[model samples]
Target: MNGCRWMLAVVLAALPVVAVAGCSSAPPPPPPESRAGRPDRGAMLIAQYGCGSCHTVPGIDRADGLVGPPLTRFGARSYIAGELPNNADNLQRWITDPQAVEPGTAMPKLGVSAIDAQDIAAYLYTLD
Candidate 1:
């Protein structure tokens, strides 16, 4: 009975330390605003230019497009137009200068400015 009481005392003494250690490892709450990264702008420009008229986006549905490839899964894509890096900056450049990158993409120069293209990219990255 004495040995059992000693073991119980040791366990009782350790309880508070174990509880404190558990709390120390706990993660803090996330921030209210999700500003982990900058939003894409090129994708926003695509919508503004009405590129959806040809390509199929998750939210957009229209006919008379057929002028370019679909962009529903562009974020997960490995390459832009199957060559350049599939990222916001590259996408913005592609949207602003398709002919410059592919040289024969048949995607006309829509006169999209750099800032507008970035806004479009910001919108597009949200798709994922």
Candidate 2:
């Protein structure tokens, strides 16, 4: 009985150490936003461009406009403006030139620069 009790106590005492050893010791990877683009900057640009006036964008203040489709879950969407495939490149292109992608799209050419478009696309992808 004494031997069994001693063994059980030893095992219990080592349990915490064993559990900790099994966990990863290295730092975690960067977030998807960082790898994809500057989502933070994108959000700011979206507001600056008055995108909220047309689309109901999450995370942006007063972004509850009903003119265009809501931008919720934009990251999970399969298409952009129901035309181009929803990818970072395609999104940037669409943002920069909506008329070029869809000739009659209600979304006008906002004159978004390439770098700004990249950041906006990055921010939209974070909606997922």
Candidate 3:
């Protein structure tokens, strides 16, 4: 009984620290604005741009192609196309002009405007 009580005391003392650690490890909540691209618009743009024709994007209809890499966990990726950093700006650049970012890459320049690219990137980032 004494040993059990000691264990309980130790657990109680460490509870707050454990909770803090858990919160710290969690990803920060997204900003409450349209800055990161409209997730809804991004989804629409993904379909409009035929992105599913090559990449298997989650949550998009008929996005089950196998030519390009699956976009699952795209938000978690550290880099884009193994070249540019995986960021909103870089993603926009890649989407609007893939050849300029990586010459000879299979991802063709889709003529995505800057805003549309942001929307697409925003949608991709939500796939965590």
**lDDT of each prediction vs. the true structure?**
0.68, 0.86, 0.87
User: In each prediction, how many residue pairs overlap at the backbone (N, C-alpha, C within less than 3 A)?
Assistant: 15, 0, 0
- Give the clash count for model 2: 0
Off by over 4 Å in 3: 1-34
The lDDT ranking, best first, is: 3, 2, 1
Q: Write candidate 3's Cα lDDT for 58-120 as tens digits.
A: 999999989889999898887889997677877888899999988999988888899998899
lDDT string, candidate 1, 78-115, tens digits: 67788786676677788789999998787877888777
**Across residues 40-102, which tens digit of lDDT does each residue of candidate 2 receive?**
999999999999999999999988889899999988887888886678888888999999998
The C-alpha stretches of model 1 lying farther than 4 A from their native spots are 1-45, 61-64
Cα error, residue 61 of model 2, in Å, equals 0.5
Number of the predicted model whose TM-score against the real structure is largest: 3
Evaluated at residue 61, the lDDT of candidate 2 is 94
After aligning candidate 3 to the native by TM-score, how far in Å is the CA of 127 from where it should be? 0.4
Q: What is the TM-score of each candidate against the true structure?
A: 0.59, 0.72, 0.72
Query: Judged by lDDT relative to the true structure, which candidate is superior, 2 or 3?
Result: 3
The alpha-carbon lDDT assigned to residue 109 of candidate 1 equals 78
